[model samples]
Target: MSRLPPAIFLMGPTAAGKTDLAIELAQALPCELISVDSALVYRGMDIGTAKPPSALLEAFPHRLIDIRDPAQSYSAAEFVSDAREAMAEISASGRIPLLVGGTMLYYRALLDGLAEMPPADAQIRAALEAQAEAEGLAALHRQLAEVDPESAARIHPNDPQRLVRALEVYRVSGMSMSEHRARQRAQKAGAGESERSILPYTVAQLSIAPAQRQVLHHRIEQRFVQMVEQGFVEEVETLRERRDLNPEMPSMRAVGYRQVWSYLDGDYARDEMLQRGVAATRQLAKRQLTWLRGWDGIHWLETSARDNLPRALKYLESLSILS
Candidate 1:
């Protein structure tokens, strides 16, 4: 275990002061920061994503930020591949790689290797779309229930993208997504140590959040309002001018952006947009907390505590990760 290179994971829900804590640790330790966020990869989405200010980013220089345009898609597989390369570079340079973000899926894929599943087939997707058009989304969902009940139960009927992809996976391969994941787990169990370990690092995982759920809810609401005051609407307006972008795109589907875009489209009044945006952000935080609650071997810190840096340092020392 000591032969593996040292790394750190700083994970937390949004508005939990994770960025500030990460910066503090980076300053104190020989560490290079790598972003694990799904939205931070986009080039033009700054205010809504609450990306670090230009000066701060320049000083810290996190890897994998602003590496893709909004028109492009970034997958968990891509994140794992890119992150491994970044980790290798940081370790080779004699510094620990400090990955920080609220994107739990990326972190999960990086920790447990992704299942090797069949790729998307355009022909199958087109057929699924046509079938949905003919026999409403509910009917398609029912079909998915018959074929892959586990995925059907997990994915909401309103989430057409995931609904379609789940069915697509079933059609492309004769196996359900759950089956593929189980197969991957079984194979890993039978494999050698070098083959089973996906992330080759002595990792120290830390999660920070407000002790009270209401405090986090309040923070999410206040932060959404603050983002709007910081010209989040204008930022979306600039992206709207791009012909290739739309509300259905993954970038625009980000919590705050979706609400602001609807407001601009006259779907609702500005007040309603603000309310919906804050609500959506709170929901996002709840989901993040749910994920963190089930995670294993993570050190928890309170967002309201002033001595988080010292506490985190002590925890790392206990783990023998910092000498």
Candidate 2:
């Protein structure tokens, strides 16, 4: 396949030093940083999301961040559209596009286009939201089991966001979520795969080695505490003012936002907020690692950030992708 410049993917778990690495790489590589983070898309979700500071963002070109209000809906399909636009502009400007962040599904959507699911139905959305509120997430799980047993089995009972989305898709399309998912899985992966495919661009996954789990966890905890010190509570309070956007909304339910919302709602003691935040971050990291382990076309750097860049550049050079 002909190269379309390197589209380096700097991905790792939460608080795993991904942003710092990406920032440093941007200074050396001919790349424009584009975020694949699901949470960073929302505006006013600053400290809790661990978003880059304004000054840092100004120092480097970044995209797909703070483009929507907290109440606005931003899905993977939307992310693909926006990310591609950013990529094109960056490429035209003679720069590589560095895709970064830990949102695995967003990265997947960027690499492999989303299936053409039906547009959402307001009525169906209302019904599913009501059912989720009244019957709770378990009932949604059972509903998923009835419609798409495979996806139901795959998704956790507590992953209310995905459960509701699956149900909504079925309700709007008059087809089971399983059917749509099956079709998506049936598609082949390769050159000229689809317009959404990022194969024309180079990609790699750099890791800090698996043995550093303890260190990673410690970093995650330290980051959350730092976020708290940096006014994470105030950030959530600002988002809380928008009551129309419930904690169940896609943007509101983002990891840090959700935890901070709980703090605002008085669900936890003041001290417990930091503890709960740290645990949620750890869970997010676990999920990120799980996703990376299953991804294809992603070569591991096999070293910590300090030693990973040169090795990663070497791998990119071998692949003829660091144009």
lDDT of each: 0.90, 0.77
Q: Candidate 2: minimum summed lDDT over ten consecutive residues — where? A: 189-198
lDDT string, candidate 1, 32-126, tens digits: 99999999999999999999999999999999999999999888999999999999999999999999999888988988878788999999999
Q: lDDT per residue, candidate 2, 227-276, as tens digits? A: 88898888788767766878878887777677778878889887887787
Among residues 3 or more apart in sequence or in different chains, the pairs in candidate 1 whose N, CA or C atoms overlap within 3 Å are none
Clashing pairs for model 2 are: none
What would you estimate as the lDDT of candidate 2? 0.77
Quick one: best lDDT, which candidate?
A: 1
* Candidate 1 Cα RMSD (Å): 2.3
Off by over 4 Å in 1: 130-159, 193-196
